[model samples]
Target: MDEKNHIITSPVMGTFYRSSAPGKAALVEEGQAITPSDIVCMIESMKIFTELRCEHPGIVKRFLVENEDPVMKNQALIEIEIH
Candidate 1:
């Protein structure tokens, strides 16, 4: 939670997915460099999946929630070290 780090949060109440689908490689990994338009993860609610994009340029520090974990609106999801 450093000032230079950006915390990404869940946009809605749903289940979080690290990849586009089961058995696929994750969209991002820890220490990966990401752009504002990068799809970091996906959130599924009501059987609909929504891709969550990065809003700042940074290196992904870690994921706060595990795959398929239920998340609430505005809940912390990922921590990124601003680059």
Candidate 2:
């Protein structure tokens, strides 16, 4: 909740994927500048993949969840530092 940090949370319970598809690049990396509209990750549930976007502009500080990791609703995915 700190002003310098912004957390990206999972909206649903599912498997988290860092890339858009298998063997693709992870959407954003640590220290990468990002905008509110950037796609940060994906959550797939019941064969449905949901694109997760940033709500605040910042640089990605770290990823809290790993690729293919099961995430719960509202689980923190990544942390970013607001620019």
Report every candidate's CA lDDT: 0.93, 0.91
1-83, model 2: which lDDT tens digit per residue?
Answer: 78888888988999999999999998888889999889989999999999998888889999998899999999999998988
Top candidate (lDDT): 1
Model 1 agreement with the true structure over 1-83: per-residue lDDT tens digits? 66898888988899999999999999999999999999999999999999988788999999999998999999999999998
Per-prediction TM-score, please? 0.94, 0.94
Q: For candidate 2, what's the RMSD?
A: 0.9
Candidate 1 TM-score versus the reference: 0.94
Kindly report which residue pairs in candidate 1 clash with one another: none
- Span of ten consecutive residues with least summed lDDT in model 1: 1-10
